[model samples]
Target: MPTHVVFIHGLWIHSAAWKPWQDLFEEKGYATSAPGWPGDRETVEETRANPDGLDNQGIAEICHHYADIIAGLDEKPIVVGHSFGGLIAQELLANDLVAAAVAIDPAPIKGVKVLPFAQLRSGFPVLGNPANKSRTVALTEKQFKYAFGNVLTDEESDALHAAWTIPGPGRPLFEDATANFVRNSPAAVNTHTAVRGPLLLTSGTEDHTVPESVTLAVVKLYADNTASVTDYHRYEGKGHSLTLDDGWKDVADDVLAWLAAQEL
Candidate 1:
């Protein structure tokens, strides 16, 4: 059976965030879907106005939502995710619901701790506040520059911020950063090894949001005991915006090559 692909967007964005990638994947004969999380806004204006609307959504519910979509597909999917979306991909894998996974700049999986300056700065807005756990936070111009736009040109970064960026829920970041939790989310506990399928970890060399060090930590933690195949790649001259940057097609093509190798 041909592999199905489900592209999950991270916090602040909705299913439309993956439109560019969806178009590229569809052309290559992979059936694709991009589902929105609960209370995800349909428009940028709406998202900006109500960034906290979905802050209460927990990891388990989101994981179950994606799993339902995967269950509906006749064939298991090769999940592709970025940032928090990457975290969700691992949760799906934990359920043994996917054939393969491609995590691009994925957020940290449990027990993986190599926080880079960039990630720290990107998360500072919420990481500093105790109340942020139940609220939303907007990335300021300066914060966004250091966190998400460190590698992009001034003009390009400004355009990207204006066009696609939205305020994001703070709870996940709080959960991701918190050292102790009684009720663990699937991502907060390292159980993805249950997945026997192939796994690929891709990180942008210039990606400050999820630096190489952090990606390495996640890879080592998850790949340690899994008997399945795993691989890693670093794209030079690329930043956190690898999905929509000038060389996005290069990343997409690289994934296609990797997918061809799997013959899924």
Candidate 2:
């Protein structure tokens, strides 16, 4: 059987956003699917209309939801994720649940001590309000531009916001923010000793949501693990919207090339 790939999306973006990616991967001779989070509706409109299902959804629950989906695959598939989905990809790989993983602009896992100002600003929409921990939050067009499309043209940024943005559960952001203080935090990943499959972590240099410095810290956390492969790639001038914007193909093609180099 051809190698299978599972694409996991992050907060505020519906699973349907991955359709172009899925199509591209399939055309390249791989079987692919983009599965939504547990409570996600089938379409962007549907998800936007009824986002309460995602309220209070935390990191552990999201990880478990994807784990269950991976369990049913005939063979361990490669996982590719963005944002919180990137965090889930790492967790699943660390658990030996996937053949390999590519985390694009991933959220900071536990042990990441560098909290850049941009990251803080990006998360402020939820973190600014204590009550958001159990609620769902939506990003305004301005907020989306700042957090995800800062490097894109206003026209392109607004188009993406209108097409893909959805309500995101605030719980994961809350959990990630407090991960260092919480014991056995769900945002934690086993980066030190897991002799698992290869991992490729990518970052956009201009990413306001997850700055390159933050991803660099995560690379350091795995520095002791010489037994496993952990590669880092930096894309200059790219932003958090690298996975969904018009330039998404460049990022996707890079991932495809990396996977090919790994012979996966």
Candidate 3:
């Protein structure tokens, strides 16, 4: 049977945004699926029209949703995720639920001490309001441009915002922000002792939402864990929109090459 691969999307982007990625992976002889988060609709329009289902959803809920999906699959599959989905990818891998994982510009997991100002500014849309913890928040075009498309051209950024952005639950942001102070936080990943499959963590140098410094810090957290493979890739001048912008294919091709190197 062909190796199965699952694509997990991050906040404010519909799973449909992974269609190009799914198509490319399938052509490479892999069976792929991009499942939405627990309450996501089948398409971007539907999701944007009715985002109330996502309200109050937290990290643990999102993790379990994907875990359940993985359980139903015929075999363990590789998971590639962005943003919070990237954080979930790490959680699933740490728990041995997937064959491998690629976390692109993933949110900072627990134990990370460096919080860049850009990251804070990026998250302020939700973090600025405490009540947002139980609500769904939508990003304005300006906010989306700042957080996800800062490095892209105005035309490209506006098009992406119109095509793919959606309301995101604020709960996960709250949970991640306080993860360091909370016991058994859902945002925590087992980076220290998991002898699991190989993992690749990528970051865009100009990413405002998840700065390179943050991803670099995550790489360091896993440095002592020589028992497993942890690789880091840096894409200079790319931003948080690296997975959806016109340059997405470049990032996707690199992931394909890396997977080939791993013989996966």
Candidate 4:
């Protein structure tokens, strides 16, 4: 079987962040695609210049974008997502588009509780202001360190900061924290109930954004597979930025190993 892989990136990041993972998966004979969020720029410089480019788009639009891609595929792809992308993966699975999926330190999808200190703090910049709901909020160096750069060296963190970090639409975060997230979205409640394919949840031990508590909370929402088919793994000394941090390759290796075991 030819397994394709689709990577859905989280908020504040474009699809480019998945380049390393895409390269790895494609080399193994799996096809790959990392579709951009609506109005997203093609490059980091362009992203910085037009941070609001994707602001007009909503979760429903983005979800449908991935769904369209999946519907066109000859074979179902193994979907991988982190943070907001994780939520998207669950949405994709709910739509029965992928064969298997892994969500890494994914953002909460309504009803899934546990507001970690880190997640709260990381979101404070935007959540504090009502006006931010329709605007793009940029991360300060400190915010970046606490949220995404904690696991990397200062140099590596600086490099990452310089290369790709940009402002993001605060509306989605607000949305996730408020209304529809709780009552409407497909991933509104634990994904295990809807997920038929193999699912692996990876949490970073040091991550505050999607802390271990949050990951476990998500696992509990699953109504079936109590025999532990839904594998949950935690990596020590890692942060929410596990997929983009210096040791990202190791994290990717673990994901690949799990996917391989499923033989998808």
**Please, what are the lDDT tens digits per residue for candidate 4 over residues 207-263?**
867777888877776646453357788899998778887789999989988887888
Q: Encode model 2's per-residue lDDT on 9-29: one tens digit a residue.
A: 998998899999999999999
Backbone collision count in every prediction?
0, 0, 0, 0
Q: Give the least accurate 10-residue stretch of model 3, judged by summed lDDT.
A: 38-47
Model 4 lowest lDDT segment of ten: 186-195
Off by over 4 Å in 3: none
- Report lDDT (Cα) of residue 93, candidate 2: 98
Q: Return the TM-score for each candidate structure.
A: 0.91, 0.99, 0.99, 0.92
TM-score, cand. 4 vs. native: 0.92
lDDT of 1 by residue, 1-264 (tens): 556899987764456768888899889988888877766778777878776667766666678778888899998888998878888887776667898888888888778767778788778887788787777677766666667678888787777677767777677777777534435645573444474677778888888788888888877876565677778888887887787666778998998899889886
Q: Local error of candidate 1 at 38, Å?
A: 1.6
What TM-score does structure 3 among the candidates reach? 0.99
Structure candidate 1, residue pairs in collision: none
| Sequence-dependent TM-score of model 1 | 0.91
lDDT, residue 34, model 4 = 88
Candidate 3 lDDT over residue span 1-264, tens digit each: 999999999999999999999999999999999999988999899999999999999999999999999999999999999999999999999999999999999999999989989999999999999999999999999999999999988899999999998899999999999999999999999999998999999999999999999999999999999989999999999999999999999999999999998999
Error of 4 at 106 (Å): 0.5
